[model samples]
Target: MKLDKELVRDVLLAVEAHDEPDRWLAIKIPGKSDIEVSYHIMLLAEAGMLKADDVGSHDGFEWVPTRLTYKGHEFLETVRDPEIWRRTKEGAEKAGIAGLGMLVELGKAYGKQLLKERLGIDLP
Candidate 1:
């Protein structure tokens, strides 16, 4: 399954919305199959963004994301705002920046620029 950054961001947002850590949450994005969602969840877990447990057989397993890590929260904060996410993705694509970490860094930079512009506060 191909990884979709938008879907991954949406999944993180969904997970963040729910505060319960012990409960199992099912991510249901329209037009996305269970396997695809599970694959993204696995990727997020591998990236250390979330904690997930694999359940079921090796051939057909389900990924149950338990909770978001501190890194996940930071990443989400970078991309949570719609304008920041759009600008960050566009800038990253233009600069050929790959990898989630790099994108998040770019987003943080853009966020700082936006803050500086809005509040006239110098951010280093």
Candidate 2:
């Protein structure tokens, strides 16, 4: 299965929204399959954005994402705004950008651009 950016955002949002830090990130998005959610959580784990434990066998996935990392919070902050997310996606699509790495970078760039526009400050 291919990576879904929207689902990725949703997963991160859900994980961040969890109030109890002691509890694991348990996501259950309606209209999404369990395996799909598992897959996204697993991907987040692999991406070094989340601290998770893989407890599944070789057959399927069963992850327990504990919390987000510093990088995860940074990325989430960049793409958290709906307008920024839409522009980021639009810019990336126009540039034929793919992969999580590039996508995140584009989002960051868009976020910086927004800051520059709003505050006349540029981030290095």
Candidate 3:
């Protein structure tokens, strides 16, 4: 299945929200159900937004660690500007409210509840 921009954005959001950076710093995204997240990471990698490196093996399975490339960090900085989000939403006619809602939901269990709370966003 092809990965979409929404999922990719979610992945980046999730990563940046990690307080235990060590947890994700050298770990491949977990759960087989999240293949699309991995696929999105691959696309980001190709776009030079992410870099994948082999960390080690797990039960005979090769584990790859993904980290934000410089470009990814830059993108994150840009998106943090509410103006960019506002303009993007306006130009694309996308549901920014719904998108932010979904992101908050993902952040709930992904170690970002404090940040979400500080931002006055509720997560599912």
Best by lDDT: 1
Q: Who is ahead in TM-score, 2 or 3?
A: 2
Query: CA lDDT of each candidate?
Result: 0.84, 0.84, 0.51
lDDT of 2 by residue, 65-124 (tens): 778888888889999888889998888779877567877999988888999999999899
The superposed Cα distance between candidate 1 and the true structure at residue 38, in angstroms, equals 1.1
Model 1 per-residue lDDT tens digits across residues 1-124: 6557788898898889877987888889898888888888888999999888887486896898888999899999988888889988888779877577777788899889888888988788
Question: Model 3 TM-score?
Answer: 0.49
Ranking by lDDT: 1, 2, 3
Q: Which runs of model 2 end up more than 4 angstroms from their true locations?
A: none
Candidate 1, superposed: residue stretches over 4 Å from native: none
Clashes of each: 0, 0, 0
How far does residue 110 in candidate 2 sit from its true spot (Å)? 0.4
Once model 3 is optimally superposed onto the true structure by TM-score, how far is the C-alpha of residue 13 displaced, in angstroms? Answer: 2.2
Worst 10 residues of 1 by lDDT: 95-104
